[model samples]
Target: MHYNHYGREPVQLGVGLLNEPCASAAELGQRCAAAGLVLSRAPTTADLASVTEFLARWRAVVECVERTGRAALLNDLLAEYASAPRLTDHAGDGWHLHFRDPGVATDRQIAALVTVGTALHLTGLGMDRLGVCAADGCTRVYADTSRNGRQRFCSPACANRSAVRRHRAGRAAR
Candidate 1:
């Protein structure tokens, strides 16, 4: 479960922002908590903005993965945000490795976590596992963490919508 932090957290952050840019801090906090990341303080509005900016950078990385440039993109993010891996029991929840230093702002922490997580997810699951949704009128991005690695849309809802559209189009074509 701790190991999943390297992949799950970042993807959750990215997908949350992608789905709703105006999400409340409470919403994000809950999401993070569910990912096992307990916060020492409430996320500020600046933290929200930081997540917005991080999403832009993260989107670029997703685009890179699409273009088979993930390595270069990951390298850039690591250079920009990720620090040396260090272990700590900051929360006294037993020791865990942190990819960035302590006492950093929420946004920077998110950047570091996402970058390292993304690198691990891509390498472990295959580079093609992360991408934008295939459904029309949807710009959501996703990390393919499915056991079968066959995720195409951001959610089953989007996939069902696409399938219905395709079915309707086929009927109209005939």
Candidate 2:
């Protein structure tokens, strides 16, 4: 269940943003860098707005995965963002894939990356891999990369809280 950039980057960006919560253009640039994304230019206000849209679309993609009949909905969303793929060693890291043509708008670039990345993630991993946290009253998303493929909570703290709640509920019922 190793995650490529396609799977790993956006998921990390989503979770990292949810955890630390920042959106200024500088903040977005920093987040992308930390996620090992190679941005050709410094982020601008427009990029911030664009990535923000990516965040919203990403949330919907997560939700779509949980619905019974909406499984194919992600493909439609990805289709809207689709671009021709090109291989590049832009960062000199190694030859890798880019989903968009060179010199596209920053926002569209992010959309392409996220859409392609998520598609790869869902396909490379299992369709059941990404899911909502099982902890009661929590709605955070998680990419279930656990070896057993049984991940439920977004974090250990949530798992512990749910456990304590269940224990107390059982005692009350008893």
Candidate 3:
């Protein structure tokens, strides 16, 4: 299933941030730019702190085993971090939706983007699409953008390692 840019990109960005967080505000700005977000200004220390807190909450959404609990967590985040949706051509590129008001702080903008994007992703794809890696000793997160939606590992390497481990375990048992 083909996913929209808004649905996929921000979730991936959220995953990236959760897995390997930024150490500083400059790094956060660089990472956001690398993720293709258009920044109105440089990130501040306060932005870094706020984003860290938001990502911790986002991690709850990822790790929630129950769909209802996950939805509740995300709903709370949406209430706190996101604003009423409005159409904007802020960059004059074309009309698009903005979940937060204009001229907000960088951290607030990111929170809105990732929160709304995650909601779109879950609703558009499946509630079970976001998950933690199944490979042993690896707790990384992943968004299941695959057509089959059976992805369990964060990377092919983890999958292969898991398969090999299972194979060896089976052989030893036999």
Candidate 4:
């Protein structure tokens, strides 16, 4: 089956980008290549700096969920991050929708996908599904793809750590 571009892949990529940042433009290019996005324009040192700056804005949107704002907040965030839609099928992979134009700077591309993809994710799933990990000292964002929609950690390790902490507390109380 054809993978859904607007689904988990984008979300995972967003988290991956947030979790591990590239120190330089070359590193950014390497990470993007590893993440499997074909760059339409050549990325430069400025592009990497811009991308890092953009990530800060994106993280604010994630933080908004701490207040448990409605989907409107997410929509507003998306609007601030994205531009007016201009469809392009640049790769000829098929006539698919692109919220931004091709051959733009890497920072612009990252912002576009992250903002729009995040909007689709929250709206398509639910607004409460995205947030930082609940485990102590862990501030990672989670996509929450579990069947019960109860995921609160960025990984199983955090989950286990939290669970073990809870178990120890319970035993001590008993």
lDDT of 1: 0.78
The numbered model that scores best in TM-score is 3
Which tens-of-lDDT digit does each residue in 71-126 have in candidate 2?
56677766677676778777666777777778877767666766777777777777
Query: Which pairs of residues collide in candidate 2?
Result: none
lDDT of 1 by residue, 71-131 (tens): 8877888888888888888876677788887787777777777788888888888888888
Q: Which window of ten consecutive residues has the lowest lDDT sum in model 4?
A: 1-10
Lowest-sum lDDT 10-residue window in model 1? 1-10
List residue ranges in candidate 4 displaced over 4 A.
1-4, 66-73
Every candidate's lDDT: 0.78, 0.73, 0.88, 0.72
lDDT by residue (tens digit), candidate 3, 1-174: 322336667888999999999999999999887777877779999999999999998999999969999999999999998888888777777777778888988998888888988999899889999999999999899988999889899999999999999999999999
Q: Write the per-residue lDDT of candidate 4 for residues 133-160, one digit (tens) a residue.
A: 8899998877767778787889999999
Off by over 4 Å in 3: 1-5
- Tell me the lDDT of model 4 at 10: 63
Q: Show where candidate 2 strays beyond 4 Å.
A: 1-4, 18-20, 66-71
